[model samples]
Target: MEKIDNIKNEINYYLNKEENVKEEWIEENHPIDIAEALSELDASEINDFTKLLETEDLADIFEESEKDLQIDILKCKSSEEIIEIFSHMAADDITDILGLLPIQKRKELLRHMKQDDALVVKNLLGYDRESAGGIMTTEYLLLSKNLTTTEALNKIKKIAPDTEIIDTIFVADSNKKLVGSVDLRDILSSDDEKKLEELMDDNIIKVSADVDQEIVAQQVAKYDLTVIPVINKSGILIGIITVDDIIDVIEAENTEDLYKMHGVDEEESSDTTLLQSIKSRMPWMFINLATAFLATFTVAMFEDVIAQVAALAAAMPIVAGMGGNAGTQTLSIVIRGIALGEIDFKDNWTLLFKEAMVGVINGAATGLVTGLILYLMYGNYYLGLIIFLAMILNLLVAGMFGFLIPLFLQSLGIDPALASAIFLTTVTDVFGFFVFLGLARGFIVYLI
Candidate 1:
């Protein structure tokens, strides 16, 4: 932590210095590390630093930084400067950055860009940010299907400097609609007399521009493609979603799931301003607080019982707290399974049976320990029996609900992570208290 703080201080100090640094010194560091160092700097300082670098270099730095920070730097720069940066950046990077900007700003930026660049960015921005279109690069090598292998190679050579790579060259018809893809290796090995149609793999796995990015990532991993083409509704090739962009999509999605499972809002970021963080989290905290009061109110219903058997108050919390922890464990698993597409609605019964089995095993183990402790501490077998029964029952309910609630919410078109934790915990707490007290009333009359 101390080392991190010192690094931050050093970066900030350099940013604050009025004098310019040598370009040689900046070039010595990796772009990603430089971007990280610049991340903590003020927007004005970032803008100044950006102006010093070439457009391509600046775009590389912007792409390396966090999405939100990229927006901050773009906001500080002028439209012309932004357009210059956009023109040089890979299409996918431009799309990701554009998605982070407000709608009005995005339009203004689009208006200022060159027509061809603007059209590509506009096409990308049309799709959901988490879709294939938004994550794909419009930088691909393309050749007419009529071209011979040698002709294709010549075309690739002519465009290689401006294009991203020649790993996979797309063959298109006269209308520029995608026909198939040819691997660079196959093209090199093929006779010059062969046409692109002869060398191309017609059974290409392509994604619609509007296909969800998660689904696109799945397809890429499923097919092990180095590049997946993105086409419009009319089957016109628009862009290519590369493995690198898909990696970012997967990481973002996993991060969102992890945060949501912890009852944290998906939008809350460590780099977010304090006010922004508070704004994102305040709603969830408020909702949790309200649900907590409901749990407290349920406990209050048995105040008379608790008063008579003061030991009930002590033991009741143990049952409720344990159930809550167990439920959270199951909740984390189910939520992640859903996000990763590992668990589906069809697997509901399977998950239910598995959780139930876990509940039985865990409850039996926990109950025996609690029962033994209660018998020893209170010198009453009846009280121990009541506690044991209540614990096992509550844990069973916790496990069942933990797996079911998220599945239920998803079916209803609500986000499972929104308040599933609060709801699940509330159920367990209220039910745990009621069962413990009610069971004690019936089975342990002498204790009461």
Candidate 2:
């Protein structure tokens, strides 16, 4: 942390001076450090820092930056400067930054970029931001499958500096279709006259442009690939998605699921203004409010029973609260498993059965403790029995809802995390109250 502060201080000293900084203004600093310092600086400071930094360095920092800051930095650059910095960046980074720009500004900036680069960026922008094309880079080497081992090595040596990842080189057929791939080590070790086709591994694993980013991450993980090639519908190689980009997709998806689980907007940033924060959160709160009242109405149905036997009222909260906790415990596990692709609609039955058994076992244990306490307090065996049965029943309900809510929402093409907790809480609370009170009412004569 202290070293990071020093890096920021060094960069700030140069930015504070209004003149052109001959001294490196974070151009030589690590991209992570530059990103951290830029995050802390104002628009003017960012503008100053961008002006003095090299385009290559700025590209590095831009690639490492958050979405809002990327736009801010892009706006800080002139058309020519934007082209220079953007051309230096990976195509995917260009798409991300351009996605955040105003329509007019984005168009103008793209117009100013080199024609081929602009075309790549424009085509990439058409893809969904969470798709394979949106995160893959066009800056990659596509070697001819006919080239000899030495020829391939020579080509790699020349193009290595321009491409993102060179650990594996893609081999293309006459139609520019991705035919096979070869590791750099194979090229380096093979006889000079060996044909590239003889060495290339033909069973190439690749994905179409429209595949979800999560699926892309899964492929990368499954194959343990540092880079995966992106092919178009016609089997033509378009670009490649690196594991670094895959890591970002994984992190962002996890964060989105986490935010949704808590009823928060996935796009909400920590730096969002108070008004913006309020706007995003108020709807969720209102929904929760409605659910709370629904639970209130359920409780209100037993008002007469509660008034007659006040002990049941105090004990009722315990049953309902415990059910809520149990439901939430199952909810967290199911939601997490779904996000990781471990649980799905196909596994719903097995998952439901497992959770139900888990619920029964957990319920029996927790119910026994509650029953004993109730028996000691009221000295009424019937009341204790009523509470114990209610506790077990409510827990089973909690477990069922926990597995079903997310699975049902997913089948309906909705994000389960967004509404699973809300519906689960309502069911557990209302049902927990209903069963506990209903049983007490049935045995009301014995309790008094």
Candidate 3:
């Protein structure tokens, strides 16, 4: 921490200089570090310090900044300055920043950019924010299938500067339809006279523009690819999604899954206002309250039995709480499996049987320990036996529902993470209390 503070201090000292010392400092340090240090500056300092950076340097730093800092930096610049920065940024990056602004501000800024660049950004923005085209860059090396290895290499040299990635070169037919891809290494090793059509690998992996970003990320992982090309309906090459973009998609998807699982809004953050936090959480809280009433009603049905056996009332929460814990453990694993495409709605007997057996085994173990402790506490064999049976049954219920509910919800096209916990908790709590209290009522003579 102290080291970071020192770096920030050094950067701040350089920023205050009147000469062009800031340029040399920027050139010497990483853009990410510079952006981090600059994030601490106030609005006036940011406005003045940013004006000293060249378009390319400013664009590099902007690309690495957090979304809030990126907005702040942009707000500090004029329309002409923003246009210059846009010229140096990748189309995907420019689209991301523009997407954050109000529609009127976005349009006004687009009007100031070059016509071709503006068109590219507009086309990108037209796709769903969570789709492949939304994350793909228009800059990629596209070689003609007819070009010889030597000609393709020469073209690559000229185009590589402006392209996002040159490791893999896409090939297209005469009509501009994507046909194949060739690694840069393959092109380098091939005979100069060999045509790209002969040298290129025809088994190309690609996605259509509208494919979901999570699916795109899965494909990339499955193929171990560094780049995947995007095609239009007619198979015309449109853009390429590089590995960096796929990584971002994976991270965002994981974060969304986690938030949904916890009943928290995905957009809720540390920066959220107090009112916004309450607004985001109120619906889930109300749903949980409704579910709580179901458990309370179940307990009320057994109130007479609990009152008769004071020990039963004391031990009531133990059974239900343990079942809730067990259910939660199963729920987390199942939801993760669904998210990673490892589990689906298919009737896999092996998965279901495995989970059931696990539930039964764990339930028996927990039931034994609980039964022993209760027997020692109350000095009554029947009281211990009642809790023993209840624990085993509740845990078995926990395991089965934990595995089944998410799949059922997914089959109905609902995100299982969002509502699975509520249903699972209600089932465990209600069933756990009913079984424990019912057994105590039946064995009243022995327990007393």
Candidate 4:
């Protein structure tokens, strides 16, 4: 704690210094640590520090920082300076930074950039920000089929510094359409006189520039590719999405899912302004409040039954709360499975059946204990029987709704994680309360 506080203090001191700090100090500190320190500073202070660093250094820092903080810094920089920094940054990094920027600012930055760079950024921005084009780097080594191994090597040497990676080179047709690929190892090992076409692998798995980023990550993992080529609709090679970029995509996607599960917008980052955080969270909280009231209303409907048999009221929350918990467990697993592409819509019924079976097993175990406890406490077999039946039924319902609600929401093109929790919990609560109260009422005379 003390060490963290010292780091925070030092960061604040440096941020407010209003003088250029030593480059050596900046270089010696870990980029991640510096980013964390910067995160603690105000946006304007971050902007000042960003301007003080070289474009390359700034790009590195920007990439290391959180996405929202990156946007904050971008918002503070001038359009021309932002363009210059983006121009010198890696294509993947530029794409990521641009993704967080406002559309108007992004367009303005593109307008100020070099035509080729601007075209690449514009093409990337054209796709869904969560797609292959948006995450891919436009920097890659390209060779022609006509080139000899020696010629290709020379071309690689000329462009190696400018390209992201020369280890994997793509071979394109005369019209710049991707034809095949060859690794640098094969090129170096082969005869200098051999044509690039002779050494190419035609089975290169390529993703369309507009392909979903999650799909791109899946393909990369499936093929165990180090670098996957990105092509336009016409099959003209535009760029390559590297494994590193895919890793970032995966992490971002996982984080988004986590946020969504908690009823917060996935776009809300830790670095988001307090106002932005409130905006993102308030709607969900309000929705949750409404759903909570619905649960309260369900309980209220049985107020007379509860007033007569106060024990029912005392035990009601336990059944409903347990069902809610079980339902959430099922919901979480299903949602994560869907995000990871492990679950398919075609297999929805199978998943539902599986969850139902799990529910039966869990419900039986939970019901037995509750039934025994009620019988021992009240000495009323009818009350125990009612509680047991209600527990089993509620658990089964919990499982069913938990599995189906997310699937139903997803089918409607809604985010399953965002609204599924409220819906599932409400179902469990209402049904649990209704079953417990209705059974008690039906057996009311026997109990008296």
Ranking by TM-score: 3, 2, 1, 4
- TM-score of every model? 0.86, 0.93, 0.95, 0.86
Residue 193 displacement (Å), model 2: 2.0
Q: What does candidate 2's lDDT look like per residue over 1-448, in tens digits? A: 7767887787677767755545354545678876876787788878887887767777888888887778788667788888887767777888888888789989998888889888888999999989998898988888999999888889999999889888799999988889999988898899999988899999999999999999899888878988999999999999999988999998998898888878888878888889988988999999999999988998899898888888998898888898889999999998887776778888569779888888888888888888989899988888788878888899999998999899889899988888999999899989999999899889988877
Q: 332-431 in candidate 4: lDDT tens per residue?
A: 9999887777776677688898888787778878878887887898788887788888888888999999988988898899988778988998899889
For each candidate in the order shown, give its overall lDDT on alpha carbons: 0.81, 0.86, 0.89, 0.82
lDDT measured at residue 62 in model 2 versus the true structure, 0 to 100: 84
Top candidate on TM-score is: 3
lDDT of 3: 0.89
Relative to the true structure, candidate 4 reaches a TM of 0.86
Error of 3 at 93 (Å): 0.6
* All candidates in order of lDDT, best leading: 3, 2, 4, 1
lDDT of 1 by residue, 1-448 (tens): 4544554565556556745555565576666777777777777777776665667777777778876678778778888888887767777678778777789988898888888888877877777777777677778888888999888888888898777767899989899889999999999998998999888988999988778888887888778987899888888888887788778878888887677756676777666788888777787788888988987888888777888887887888888998898898898899877766677666578778888788777987898899899989988887788878887888889998999898888888887876678889999988998898888777656785
> lDDT score of model 1?
0.81
Deviating ranges (above 4 Å) for candidate 4: 1-27, 43-52, 71-80, 98-112, 269-279
Better candidate by TM-score, 1 or 4: 1
Q: List the residue pairs that clash in candidate 3.
A: none
